[model samples]
Target: MRTLAERAGVSSATISLALRGHPRISAATRRRILRLAEQLGYRPDPSIAKLMLHLRTRRPPGFQSLLAALTTVPEAEEQPYLRELRRSAQARAEALGYGLTVLRVAADAARRPDLERMLRARGVDGILLLPMAAPREFRPLLDWRKFSVVSATNAVLAPQFHRVVPHQFSNALLLCEELTRRGYRRLGLVMNSRHDLTVGHGPSAAVVWQNMLGGTERVMPLIFDPAGAGDLREWFERERPDAIIAEGADNAQDIARQLGLRVPGPVGFVTTNRSGPSVFAGIEERPDEIGAAAIRLLTSLIQHGEKGIPKVPTVTMVAGAWVEGRSVRAPSRAAPRKAATA
Candidate 1:
């Protein structure tokens, strides 16, 4: 500060105000001071900058405020996975000296009265969106310019808010390689198209790409409607794959039984998420970690007063951990018997 002020022929106080772009400093003086600082390579330390910001925004005790986890999904408490995300987010918010609340806003306008008003009334300035099973556009009547917001799902297509999610692409590729290492070939991927699109088709695309890289006969992915479970068995029978990768636990179990196959005995099975205790080897999405990261990002945005859709939206991916379960095994190496002489 002293050196720059001397070079710019100004007092240290004038240099500080000019560099900070305080309104009291004339524009010409601000430009001059900035140019001098640049020439001197006088960059402010980030720690000092953050301390100065904290001093400026310091609130008296008891003024510490609330943030919100906004959701459109009903009966969120009944869903243990959603509960885990909320719990993790709340814990992180508390750790950052802010209280967090979960607010369920109905999708229907009749039931969802002015969400913006509700938020402003409670003085909530930051919002964390929970993951949804299906993609939905956020057509809020509220003024989005007033608050910092982020989503934990790709389901929010409108406004393209920043997101934090599982690394579906790499995770799927890793799973396929792991399955191959276990001596399982003829891998089949089955998932609902809607759900696949909701996650940006990374998992499904990875499966196909991996199969293509193997330089063998291409196996088609079996995409089925999740609401229609009856066809699952039919697809399994038709594909006759040595192993299957799916997202639903019940559907996988049912298809395995219909084929008269025991998991890891005759055929192998893998699930995409560890939503519950199961005998299937799968990936753990770790919603808790994702939730914590969302809070961390949201807090930074709130502190910076960044609101509305970001010009450069970012998607932060958390890699899922693989869980080894009793659902896969090494492929049979028995030689094919010679065809009977005809």
Candidate 2:
């Protein structure tokens, strides 16, 4: 910085302000300072800036403030699951005497320079990424050593990074096993193929279903496509599965009716995520618990000045609960009869 300022014929403070693009510095002087800094190979130290910020800001005692960044494309609104997870995390943070700030990274901010600048300027101590539909391609862009980070879902697979997510594979296996125990042999899976491809969670569930079937032809895969309901109908008719495990109960019920199958009798259903008001049998991935755990981990890292990937990072898995509903029926129940006489 000294050499750059001398070469630019400006005071050291002027050079610092210009290099940082402070509004007080004239644009022409800023350009000159940047060019001189480049000639001298000057790089601003982030640690120094962090120390300065700490000295300037007088934080209240026992207060641990952190930034929870949600890296998504611009215009991404809060979905139901994300809203619930954020609420749980925020509530937990408050209980622990910490302040939580949510940040959304725009698509253009994925670039390295922009991301680093934003994080450093904000002085974020930690970050918690919400579940993303696809793995973000910005892992290598930022300096991970500056802040602690935790992904809310297994959708992002960064080795040696702490992750908190539900045990999806085990949940699927347990769901299938329970259905088999209840004498539902011919079971089928209905899911959105696009969602599966984006997150790789669907394939894990499929593997569990296949194992539960014991190499038999009792397992069927019925992928849903909004533009191709006719194809789905044909597949359902030909498969004729006695029971269906679907992600959404209402959609599954409607499809079952379209195939001339009576619910809880000729065809049974189970919801993968019981999101709506009605209760249904399925796995409840305890997202709220996962969110709270992530915040706790982040706090630990911040308190210890631990950053980047831990040398021995750990993964925490919260098992899903089996919720029983009226959609499923035991095989011993009598078959459905025609409409009763008036």
Candidate 3:
């Protein structure tokens, strides 16, 4: 410590705090100290660090370390995506020598007090917020200073902390380009307004960006109201899109059939969410991977004693991969022309 402090021209105390990512230390100084430490091949011994933590905390000898999976509802009522998220989080936490606990925040006014009391009593070291379909802000009632926290959902809008989520924009771009390569010229994206907003408008914007790149007439997105009677035939006749990208390829195929259009014969379809059967060519947003990444980030924050809302929150995005299905196939333009002539 003395050697590093002398080389970095900082007091030994400052060097110690900077190495531990203490919030009181300036970020610039921290970086400089870390760079110097790396250059000098200086590393902290884990055994000593653990011993120091034990001495400081004076935790019960048999107490098991724990991490919390914070959610809005119980696991049984959670959506399939959220269930996968929780499952993966639990697996990762267990592997890291910590038990995972699911705590659902009640919707009532007494939520904050009860939740905070339980967390405090359990001595949770970190928290992982599960993803939600609708955007939300973490309740301000709970004291955030107690534990390191991370959200796995982009739906969180306030008290910005570090988050892990799907790379929606890049995933949409990849899907669009792949569809174009399959000879889909007039491609259209179908999404409800709420779904568009929930994903931060990534899918809608991706389609528009792709249209600009090709200098082609932009096939305006089909934004339908979920509650209203969405007339797919009317939109198809007006837009004349060669392919449609939506949440469900099966439903898109059904809509085409109802309009006397053959799937993959005249119009191709792609799905964004592949929760059930792989009947559509689309992107698979891997919720499991997102959950694992969130746990990893949360553990790092806990290790470095990072807590509360970060001044500059960082987002880590996991890119989804394309799943090929029978709903979309290579376009046969020549065959179509021949059939038209015949």
Candidate 4:
């Protein structure tokens, strides 16, 4: 400050105000001081800058008082994994000296009020939006410009905002390779048709891509629709995959039981998205970690006052951790013999 002021023939106070673009400094003097500072390569120390910012804002650091989660509450049987996300997010927010409020809006509701107004009324300047099974209405349902919004789901495809989620594609690819390396020849993917949208189709795509990279063995994915189980057994028999990968371990086990197949005896089971520690071998999506990370990003956004959807939205992907469980087994010498037709 003194060096720049001396170079520009001004007091250090004038140099400071001019560099900060304070209107009190005359335009010409401000420009001259700014030019001198640039020539001197002056950069404010971050600690000093933060201290000055606190003084100017007349508020303590962490000015963001509260944050809210705007969610389209799903039907009772919907994604139960989201429950863990909210719990973990709330815990993380409190740890960071911020408050987290979950505001629910039913997906089937007829009247969708001004969500932003309600949020503002609650004094929330930041948001963590957990989109419903179908986020088609995410745009029309909320005012994007009023808050620093971050999504915890990759399913929020339209009118994009910054998001944090698991590395679904890589997780799937890793699962396939792991199974194959263990001697499973034909690998199968069974999951809800709607779930394809949830992880952004990363698992589905990765499975297909891995299949393409393999030898002759291949199994077409069975996209399960709850309305109709739709030949899950027939698909399993036809594919005769040595291993099965489903959304969760429970789904895989149930499907195997229904098919009268011996799990890990002939056919191994693994889950692509494990909710938590389990007896299933596969990737742990770690919704808790993802939730914590989302809060961290949201706090940074709020601190910077980055309200509104970013022009180039960012996605922070947390890699899924491989959890060894009893569901999978050693490499298969050959796929189980094909089942007989009716």
In each prediction, how many residue pairs overlap at the backbone (N, C-alpha, C within less than 3 A)? 0, 0, 0, 3
Once fitted onto the true fold, the runs of candidate 4 whose alpha carbons sit more than 4 angstroms away are 1-42, 46-63, 74-80, 108-111, 330-342
Question: Which tens-of-lDDT digit does each residue in 193-288 have in candidate 4?
Answer: 777877888889888877777452767988877667568878877888878888886787788788887655667788987776676788877888
- Model 2 lDDT tens row, 265-326: 65677766555455357776677887899888777666545678778877787777777777
Task: State every prediction's TM-score relative to the real structure.
Answer: 0.77, 0.67, 0.74, 0.77
Q: Please give, for residues 204-227, the per-residue lDDT of candidate 3 as tens digits.
A: 888888776754457978887767
Give RMSD to native, each candidate.
8.1, 13.2, 8.2, 7.9
Q: Can you tell me which runs of candidate 1 are displaced by over 4 Å?
A: 1-63, 76-78, 108-113, 215-217, 227-230, 257-260, 330-342
Model 3 clash count equals: 0
lDDT of every model, 2 decimals: 0.76, 0.65, 0.76, 0.76
Weakest ten-residue segment in model 2 by summed lDDT: 333-342
How good is model 1 by TM-score? 0.77
* Candidate 1 C-alpha lDDT tens digits along 1-342: 999878888899998777665545655777778887888899898998899778865753233567988776787333655778888998888876788988776654233346777888898978888876467777553566777888898877776888998898877876776677677777888888778887889889888987788532356888776676546666666767888888757757876777777876767899877667888888888889999999989977775457788999999998887777889874345522222110
Clashing pairs in 1: none
Model 1 lDDT-worst window of ten: 333-342
Name the lDDT value of residue 106 in candidate 2: 52
